[model samples]
Target: MTEALLELKDVYISYLGVEAVRGVSLRVTERDFVTVIGANGAGKSSVFNAISGLVKPAKGEIWFNGERIDRLTPPQIAGRGVIQVPEGRKIFPLLTVKENLMVGAFMQRDKKKIAENFENVYRLFPALKERPTAKGIRLSGGQQQMLAIGRAMMANPKMILLDEPSLGLSPIFCQQLSRQLKALHNEGKTLLLVEQNARMGLSLANYGYVLENGELRKEGTSAQLLNDDEVKRAYLGV
Candidate 1:
C-alpha cells in the first residue's frame, strides 16, 4: 500500500471547553482524492482547521509527508505545501486576479517556477486568464471560486484541503466546479475535501468518510456510501 501523505491519528479538537472533534482518525495516501461529508456542526471544518494548524488539537497527531504537523503554525504547515482553499471563496476583494494568485506563491523564491505556476493556473482557468487585471470583487461567485482554487494551485501544493468549495454555487457552476476538481485529481494532486453536500462530495471522490456530531460514523469507497441505505436517507435525501 502507498504510504499516507496525510494522516490524522485519534485527533481531537475543542473550542473553549467544548469538543468539536472526537478522535477523528483518517488518512489520505499520495495522489488520493478523499472527501469528508457531514451536516452542519459535524466537525468537518474542525478537522480541516486542525490539519491546517489554524487551531491546535487538544489530543492526537497530524502527519504530512512523514512529518508531524499538528504542532506547527499555519504558515509553517502551508510552507510544507499543505495548502487550503478555505470556504466562502476568501479571495482578496481588492486585488486583481493575477495579484491574488501571486499571493499564494509567496513562499516560492524561484521566479521560473512561479512563472510556470501562473501559466498552469491560467491554462486551467481560462475565465481567469480573460480578466487577469479584474478585481476579485468584480467576478461572479463561480469565478471567485475558480480563482480560489487557481490560487491554491499557485503554491504547488502536494495536497489541498478544500472546505465547502461548492457551497453556494449555482447548479451549472457546481457541475463545472466538479469537473475542475476531477481534473486536479487527474493531474495527481492529492485532495481532502470537506463538504455538506454528500452526494456531490461522494461523486467527486474515490473514497469518503461520514462525520456526525464530532465523530466518524461511517467510511467506505464512494460507491459503497452511495449504495448504503443509511447514507442515502441521511445525506443523499433519497
Candidate 2:
C-alpha cells in the first residue's frame, strides 16, 4: 500500500473557544488530487489553516510525509513543501505581479531555482507573464486568481492546499482554472483543495471528503460522491 503524503489525524481547531474544525481527518497520497466540499462557514478554511500551521490544532496530529507537523511553525511547515493558496486570493494589492511572485520564494536563496520557478509559473499562467508589471489590485478577478496561483507556484511546493480556488469568478474563468489544476495533477503534484463549488470539486478531484459543521461527513471517490443522493441534494444540486 502506498503511504499517504499528507494526513490529518482527528484534528480539531478552535477559535475563541468556538470549535472551527471538529475532529476532521483525511489523507492525500502521492499524485492524488483530493478535495473537501462544503458551504461557507463549514470550517473548510480552518482545516486548511491547520494543515499549513497557521492555526495550531487544539488536538490531533497533522502529519506530512510521515512526520508530525502540527507542532511546527508556519515557516517551518512551509519549508517542508506544503504551500497554500489562501481563500480570497490574498495577493499583495500594492505589489506588481512579479513582485508578489518573488515573495513566495522568501525562503529560497538560489537565483537559478527562482528563475526556473518563474518560467514554470509563466508557463502555467501566460496571462500573468504578460502583466508582470501590473499591480495585483488592478488585475481582473480571473487574473488576480491566476496571479495568486502563480505566486504560490514560486515556492516550488511538493503539495498544494487550495482554498476555494473557484470562488467569485466567471464560468469561463472557473473552467480555465480547472484545466490548469488538472494539468498540475496530471504532472504528479499532490493537491488537497477545499471549495464550496461541489460540482467542480467533485469533477476535478479523484477523491473527496464532505465537510459539514466542521466535521467529516463522507469520504469516497469522486464518482461515488457525485452519485450519492444525499451529497447530490445538499452539495451537487441534483
Candidate 3:
C-alpha cells in the first residue's frame, strides 16, 4: 500500500467545550480522491479544519507527509503545501482575481515557479483566465468558487482539503464544479473533501466514509459505500 500523504489518528476536535469530531481516524493517500460525507453538524468540516490547522486537535494526531501537523499554525500548514479552500468561497472580496491568486502564493518567493503555477491554474480554470482583474466580489457564485480553488492551486499544494465546495451552488453549477474537481484529481492532485451532498461526492470519490454525530459510521470504496444500504437510505435518498 502507498504510504498515506495525510493521516488522522483518533483525532478529536471540540468547539466551546463540546466535542465536534471524536476519535476520527482516516487517511488520504497521495494522488487519491477521498471524501467524507455527512449531514450538517456531523463534524465533517471540523475534521478538515483540524487537518488544516485552523483549530487544534483536543486529542490525537494529524500527520502530513510523515510529519506531525496537529500543532502547526494554519499558515504553517498552508505553507507546507496542505492548502485548504474553505467553504463559502472565502475569496478576498476587494482584491482582483489575479491579486487573490497572488496572495495564495505569498509563501513562495521564486517568481519563475509562481508564474508556472499561475499558468497551470489558468489552464485549469479558463473562466478565471478571462477576467483576471475582476474584483472577487463581482464574480458570480460559481466563479467565486473557481477562484477559491484556483487560488489554492497557486499555493502548489501537495494535497487539498476542500469543505463543502458545492454549498450554495445551483445544481448546474454543482455539476460543473464536480467536473472541475474530477479533472484536478485526474491530473494527479490529491484531495480530501468534506461534503454534505453524499451522492455527488460519492460519484467522484475513489473512497468514502460516512460521518454522523461526530463519529465515523461507515467507510468503504466508493462503489461499496454507494451501494451500502445504510448510506443509500440515510444519505443517498435512494
Candidate 4:
C-alpha cells in the first residue's frame, strides 16, 4: 500500500475541560481530495486546527510524510508544506489583494519564485489580478473566498486544509468554487476539506468521513455516503 502523505491516529483535543475532538483518526494519501462533513459543533475546525498545529492534539499522533508533527508550532507545520485556508476568509482587511497573497509566501526567500507564484495565482483567479490594488475588505464575499484559496495556493503546499470554502457564497459561486477545487485535485494537490454543505462536499471528495459530537461516525467513498439514507436525511435534508 502507498504510504499516506498525512495521517492522524487516535487524535484528541480539548479546550479547558471540554474535549473537542475525541479519538479521531483519518488519512490523506498523496494527491487525494478528502472531506470531513458534520454539523456546527462536531469538531471539524478543531481537527484542522490540530493538524495545522494551531492546537496540539491532547492524546494522539499527527504524522506528515512519515514524520511526527504533533509537537511542532504552527509556523513549523506550515513550513513543512501543510497549509490551511481557514474559515471565514481571514484576509488582512487593510492589506491590498496582492499583499495578502504575498503574506502566504513569507517563509520563502526566492524573489523570482514568489513572483512566479503571484502570477500563477493571478492566472487562476483573474478577478484578483484585476483588483490587485484593492483592499481585502473591499472585495465581495465570493471574491474574498477566491482570494483565500489563492493565498493558500501561494504557499505551494503539498496538501491544503480548507475549512468551509463555500460558507457564505451564493449557489452559483459555490458551484464555481467546487469546480475549481476539483481542478486543483486533478492538478495533483492533496486536500482535506471541512464543509457543511454535505452534497457539494461529498460530490467533490474521493473519500468522505462523517463527524458527530467530536467523533467519527461514519467513513466511506463519497458515492457510498451520498446515497446512504441516514446521510441523506440528516445532511442532505431528503
Model number with the top TM-score: 1
Report the C-alpha lDDT of model 4 over 29-107, residue by residue, as the tens digit. 9999999999999999999999999998889999999899999999989999999999998998899998999898888
RMSD of each: 0.7, 0.9, 0.9, 0.9
- Candidate 1 weakest ten by summed lDDT: 117-126
Tens digit per residue, CA lDDT, model 3, 133-168: 999999999999999999999888999889999999
Local accuracy of candidate 1 as per-residue lDDT tens digits, 1-238: 7789999999999999799999999999999999999999899888999999999999999999999999999999999999999989899999999999999999899999999999988887889999999999999999999999999999989999999999999999999899989998998899999999998999999999999999999999999999999999999999
Return the lDDT, model 4, position 132.
Answer: 94
lDDT of 2 by residue, 100-204 (tens): 999998888999999999998898899998989999999999999888888788898999989999999999999999999998888678888999999999999
Instruction: Give the lDDT of residue 49 in candidate 2.
Output: 92
Q: Candidate 2: where are CA atoms >4 Å away? A: none
lDDT of candidate 2? 0.92
Clashes of each: 0, 0, 0, 0
Tell me each candidate's TM-score: 0.99, 0.98, 0.98, 0.98
lDDT of each: 0.95, 0.92, 0.92, 0.93
